[model samples]
Target: MAEARRMPSETAPAGLRERKKEETRRLLREGAARLFAERGFEGTTVADIAACANVSVRTFFRYFDSKEALLLPDGIKVFAHVEDALAGRPADEEPLDAVCNALLAAAEPFAASTLTALGHPLEDIENVVTGRLVQAFSAFEERLTVLVRRRLPADTPDADLRAAVIAGAALSTVRAVLRTRRARRASGMTETGPAPLPRAFEILREIGSAGRP
Candidate 1:
């Protein structure tokens, strides 16, 4: 019988390799963002991103399946924030109100947060990053709609679907408003106020609450 292959020993070297992989991924993502911002997403090539990150083209592929994935950055964190918000709703809160509240809270970080406030102008990066963010968010809307449906009472008629639709619409509206605000600020409109996330949630709650009675 052939001898069994010895498994690699579990040790410090293995830990170091994992850490190195994470660092490489972070570097690649940052480099790709810089290039995409500078050259436009359609104009930038994977090889260019690799060169920026100081890694081989093959290594770029290892970190990101494709250039599109590079635009998404860390999805796990976004989803986790959403989940956490949902988990924190008050027991007395209506389902739709709870969801709206959760989404409003979860989305705050992205709306006029430091990332959008201090970074390169998003309007300039629309071709590469902003456009992709919109598409990804549209998909997220569909997923959230399904999640609403799953969480609804069995006898609930349009409430589930309506909540999901409103949730998506609300998020889309908020994003559009924020984009315009960012653009205005870039053009020297220095006194932009907070994005209308809370108002959007209020609208969603109003529509959803009507179904309760």
Candidate 2:
């Protein structure tokens, strides 16, 4: 029998190749973060990241197009994962809880984001990238709002506004978690796993209920 094609684009079983690609991506991201932290942006070259990950500079480009690209959030994979997870959520689950849990399900890779792991303040990032982050997050809010709307009752009062607020609040909670990551890493501390996320949702629930009765 002929050797099965192992390319990621090939139709044959490529599980091992895909895993290797994923692992390579993770290593490059981690290497980029470490170097960016130690040397700042301009000082950290693509060659340096490749060297850190034990790959050729050519291989680095195959993964990330550029150093700046490495610093951006993993929005595409995250959005897709969140969408699928939300679809899998139980129909009877509360809207907020379903959304929260779905977001949490997509948290691991996101929470370990390279730029976030660097723990730099917003002001420290370039103005162009900072603007891009703002744009990216607005898009994130819109997507999350759509998911939130689906879980809400059809007869929800001021349905659009309510759903938007729920989505905004959920996105804010995620932002809080990422910000906490920056702060903790800056202070030489470590993350508290997903504990902060649920705790944030708990606080939001308290505030929401406080106005109810």
Candidate 3:
């Protein structure tokens, strides 16, 4: 009998392919951040970022819609994750606690790597990406309002206004902490020093309570 021909090894699993894609995207993001920092966002080109990432321009486009998207590499994912976190909170949990926890969860990645692959601090990137950051935060505020509204009693008076105020306050608290941390770092503070997230959360909780009837 003729020997049965063996088929090539099964195609790579979906999970493996996804992991590879994510890895490629991450490399491109880091590469772009470094190049943008070194050469300035306007000075850097897509081709330059692709070269730095060792990927083709096509591959870069696959991961990011445009160079500006590099400013917040995982902006959509971060906000989506925060929304999911808020949705998963215990039904009876205080609105403040839910929002604070969601924000903290979303901040984990930044806390893990406070600096870019190029060894430039995040604050430096923030300075370069302020415009993009504002746009991202505006989107964040809308989502946050929805989340806050869901946590409030349906019959509450001026629920929309209250939700907007809470969302604005919460975001402001986070931004304030970020500014303080950046200033402290600029003053030569150690990287391992106290974190500002906790303080920000504390203030958020206070704001939440104050808004309650």
Of the candidates shown, which would achieve the greatest lDDT relative to the real structure? 2
34-125, model 1: which lDDT tens digit per residue?
77667766678889989988899998888887876665545566666776777787765666666667767765464334235225555445
Give Cα distance to truth, residue 129, candidate 1, Å.
Answer: 4.5
Query: What TM-score number comes out for model 1?
Result: 0.64
lDDT tens digits by residue: candidate 3, 1-213: 233332223334666789999899888887886786688666889999999989999988898888877766456766787788788888898776777777777654543442444465545555445444445555678779988998999998999998888788766766676666667666977656446787678766776569688
Question: What is each predicted model's overall lDDT from 0 to 1?
Answer: 0.65, 0.72, 0.71
Top model number, TM-score = 3
- Give me the displacement of residue 72 in model 1, in angstroms: 4.3
Error of 3 at 204 (Å): 3.5
Lowest lDDT sum, 10 consecutive residues, model 3, at: 1-10
TM-score between candidate 2 and the true structure: 0.61
**Would you estimate the TM-scores of all the predictions?**
0.64, 0.61, 0.65
Question: Which pairs of residues have clashing backbones in candidate 1?
Answer: none
